[model samples]
Target chain A: MTTMDHLAEQTKLERLLQVDEGSLGFVAEQEVQATRAFRQQLSEFYYQRHQDAFHRLAGLSKLLPISASAKLAMNLLGPVLAAGIACELPKDRAAKLAGRLPTDFLAKLSLYLEPSRAGAIIAAVDEDHIVEVARHLIAQQEFITLASFVTVISESTLRRIIQQVGNDGLSLLKVGFYVEEKTALNNVVTLLSEQQRRALFLAADEHSLWPAVLSLLPYLNDTLQGEMSNLAAEGEEQARDKLVRAVAQQGDWYPLLLSWTRMSQENLESSIRLPALHEEALLRECMAQLEKHNLQQALPNFTELLTEEQQALLA
Target chain B: MSSPIETLRQEGLPEQALAYLTALPEEQQQTLAQQVLSTMQKKDERVEKALSRALDVVPAPLRRTVRKMLFS
Candidate 1:
């Protein structure tokens, strides 16, 4: 590796070490193995280019947090840590940590640790601290229990948390929020709760909201379907024409079309008609695209919406 | 008698296959099984031709073993 690469790796390792004890323990174990693999690769490269390797390592030591002596110490001790201490320390500490942690933190932390009990402790930490730790753990991809964290934290609270974390924080928050929102939306739809469905619909304007809506489609009730259909019709002519255009540009209109079809089927006369005065070509193009994508499975109630001719066209 | 692979495939096992593949170590076992199954299907005509050609040189007992190994 070049000096810059070595420096970068060391910085990452330092950052990993600086994390909370629970996170540090997890990362140290992962890094010890990764470093061994990296060292072997570096050694092979060094053998082929001795001068290059020496220069890189020399420069890298200068740039890295560790002094040359420390690097040497790590080179010697890292294996012992990774193999013996890393494995052994966490097993006991993790249990102690879990017993001390709160229920919410324990839940989130469980997603990252190997033995479920250990994870429970890491997750059980204080909520604010857990959020910070979770942010760090997520950056390292160490914590796998993100879905659990979503249940305890509301979407609005998650959004505020992301705002505080800044842009990079927002990106991670978005991923976690998307997963959580989708699960919550699906849960609401399965329960067919009117209030929950309306809440999800209001939240739908955000890009992060689509996954939740997509997930809920299969379980959507007639009331929810009709609400979405009305939104689509109203949205098409609203001042926020840009939003409608964006949805249209997404190419695969299966979800919207399927929802609309279901709503129309449920309340055939009351539902919005395909405006006869509108462009027939646009509607035809969408129908053709749906057929091309073979998305008929999403529109199982198409027979109720279309006439024999249109039904045949779909077939 | 159903083999493990056959039983798995018959049980609408794609979901299970995906879950197994996700959880498995990045070793050759999972991928190799998939590759072998796909190749067996795609090269069925060539396999039949090769088997017909082999019957002339090999005894029926040896042929059965080869057939079972390749097809299974």
Candidate 2:
């Protein structure tokens, strides 16, 4: 590599290593100085909860009542970490243990297991049990748990589970937020039909889900943006205001404008085709707002795009 | 012909074009982006300098220009 290119690569690697080390040190510091409330959260992960789960499971290893061999194994281990001890089990044995456990218990345990290992166990689970566990997780709004398990699921099963929970707006959005897989966001968006997507805003405003809606909006493709804009344009006053305010607050116009650029020609023609926009009085008011916001410079050619009658309103 | 921006609207959101311009790293945004603003005039150094002057004169937010340029 060229000396300059190598140096750039070296610097980038150094920056990445620094970030990793800094975060590790920060976590260590936090642990050392963790406060009372943090201790409460940490209490939830007591090694004993896991040890209890393992002890309870080990005591039931035989098909019949607690067997002598199983009892001895549980007695000898003294204290096994509950989280991933199951991974050391043969696949058949792990699957059998998972099959016998209550699904909610399995779901809770799944959250603490390594994702790849969890995925392996989940693959052995029956769809009926999987569905029940997923339903429970969704109801509990366990997005982190949900996200963890998605990494291991087959796509078709994932789609099935997603479709089942698709309409629970806020919970679905939370899972969308927590997903670790990079394409998981867009994949979720793609699963929604256009009508289902458009309906989110009406629900957003009514349910005060607008902030989440806004956050997720930019992640969706352009057509959805236009669809949303058109829906907003047709919506109530506060809805339109919310749209304007979001567009106003954006640091970059690219996401919204890019959506505009990809909008159907029919939709583009229609944004200005509003009879209201053409009304001189409304035009004047909007122009005044635009000017008040110091946007007059951006529309240098705006007057030319207007009818002479509309242009007169600028005066 | 309508302005390139208007034509772009007809073509549908210039998601790909903006992604290319911004070099956005997100897989979904970049993967789906396509050049929707193909009719844009090639950069003219003269126009660039003139607009640069105009920008200095009015000092408007580029966002306003982008807003009007795309949606007006």
Candidate 3:
């Protein structure tokens, strides 16, 4: 699995257990599906153990008027229990209650809400409310909660949220790294304007987020991957050097090289021209990866771009 | 006395979850196992505690009614 896959699984596990990130890093090598399955089991176990109480709260919501139920949840049950009760309530009713609750409270509740279990409830909520809660979560740095909900929201709602998120590429990068659905992330990328797309590369440079940027490249379609790689090459030489060094440090040139195949010839040449790429050790390692993955054919354009000395080293 | 790994197995943690934990250094395993157990054990405790706090906020006469609404 890629580093992002491991991080994604680790993030999900951490969120499931309400633990800090890195607390579960030991499990980074476990199969992603195993982490997912284990999280599911834990969720099911907790829900089963507390179903009666949560069901009771759901029952009470049905017994009371909608506004009163919302008050009871906010004033009494708190976000965690309220979220549990909301999961058990009818999706429409939960949506109505969500409307009555404050966006801040809803944002708090979202941290505990299981997207898979409450997908319909989340979908039933108004787009405006979802946007409001998303803003609140973003302000609070609740990217994990935001990322978890990404899979459940309508694409249109997501587009609106991304629009509101504007040019904060770093926030999107952090959330994207933890996103479980790469295709959803890819779709989100498709929605970006050229400026927004460029901001992502700039953010990667400014924030040393090349690993995240590199990990994300493999998920984009050929056109977007090429476009993104071209954009990445437009960064300063120092930034490009940082990216190449990051790849070398990661010891995983697969994502970088694979993206090179899709890049415009000029952009690929620009990327390969980085002084960092000429490092003997790094070039040899890149060649080894190319041979290991049987992808030399993927880099025909790249071969023409290499210096004579670099080509000799790679050969 | 069972090992921390065994204790986790007995605590209803799934095999897949423990499999990763089992690979850690013994000291790390003990630490992580304790952490996992604490998180798992918090479910009931947190619910009961939250319910108690909720009940404490209700008017005396309404507390019983709310309790009935919740448990009934």
Candidate 4:
């Protein structure tokens, strides 16, 4: 599994166990899907152990008036129990009760609600309410919660939230890092305007988020990856060195070389000429990674950019 | 030999998840399983404590009904 996958799974486990971040670092070497499966079971077990309580609280929605149920959820059940009961309630009824509650309460409840179990209710809630809750989550820097909803919320709702979340490239990158579904992430990238997309590159630079930027590159479709790479190529020479150095240090050359294969010749040359690329050790590591990934076919032009001395190292 | 996989299996961990845990080295499996066991216990205890505190504010007549509905 990729580093981002490990990070995403670790984040989910932290929430499931209510432990501090990095507490589950021991599982970092496990397969990401296996870790995800393990988390799913633990989450289900937690809810299952309390199913009777959740179901009883869900029963209140039927027994009490909608207004009273909403009040009871806020004042009596509190967010955690309210979220558990929300999962047990019928989708329409849950949406109705949610509508009657405050956005702040909904935002707090969102932290406890399992997106998988509450997907239907999330879809049923008003777009405006979801947007408002998203705003609250953004203010709280709850990107993990926000990212979990990416799978369930409609494309249009996500678009609106992205617009509201504009210019904060670090926020977008952080949320995107935790997003598990590549297609969903692609949609998010597609929704971004050219200006918004440019801001992301700048944000990565400003925050020194190159590792995340590199991790995200391979997941985007070819056209967008090439576009983003060409944009990075347009940056000052110092920025180019930073990008190349990050890839060399991380030892993930496939994404960078793949981007090289797609770049306009002018941009590719600009990228490969960075002094960082000329270092013999970095070049050797890059060639090894390229061969490991079997990407030599894509980089004939890239090879031509290197001087004979560097070319000899590859030989 | 006693193993983490066996301990987790006894706790009724789902088979699919247990398969993943079983793949780890014995030492790591032991550590991860212990963490899982402790997390479950901690979450259960925390919820029980929070519920008890939440119930303290309920009116006397309704508290009995709420307790029966949930804990019973």
Task: List where candidate 4 sits over 4 angstroms from the true fold.
Answer: A307-315, B1-8, B22-31, B46-68
| Per-residue lDDT of candidate 2, residues A1-315 (tens digit) | 112112222222222222322222222222221222222222232222343334333323332232332232333321123233465455566666556656666566555555554467668767777777788788777665676576677676677777778656566655654554535566666666555565555666666545445555566566655565565445565564554344434323333333334445544344433455566655565556555655546445445556666666666
Predicted candidate 1 versus true structure: per-residue lDDT over B7-62, tens digit per residue: 33553335433343234344433442344244334333432443344333335666
Best-performing candidate as measured by TM-score:
3
- Name the runs in model 1 displaced over 4 angstroms: A1-177, A180-185, A188-193, A206-212, A215-244, A264-277, A293-315, B1-72
Give fnat for candidate 1.
0.00
Task: For residues A81-186, write the lDDT of model 3, one tens digit per residue.
Answer: 9999898899999999999999999999999888889999999999999999999999998988898888999989889888877889888887788777777777
Clash tally for model 4: 0
- The residue-level lDDT of candidate 3 at B60 comes to 81
DockQ of 1: 0.01
Better of 2 and 4 by DockQ: 4
Q: Candidate 3: which pairs clash?
A: none
lDDT for A28 (candidate 1): 28
Which residue pairs in candidate 2 collide? A261-B12, A261-B14, A262-B12, A262-B13, A262-B14, A263-B12, A263-B13, A265-B10, B16-B33, B16-B34
User: Candidate 2: which stretches are off by over 4 Å?
Assistant: A1-81, A207-211, A214-237, A250-254, A266-315, B1-72
Candidate 4 displacement at residue A281 in angstroms: 0.8
Give lDDT tens digits, candidate 4, residues A12-106: 78877777888778677777778888888888977887776678767755677799888878877788888988998999999999999999999
Model 2, residue A80: displacement in angstroms?
Answer: 11
Please tell me which predicted candidate would have the highest DockQ against the true structure: 3
Better of 3 and 4 by DockQ: 3
The candidate with the higher DockQ, 1 or 3, is 3
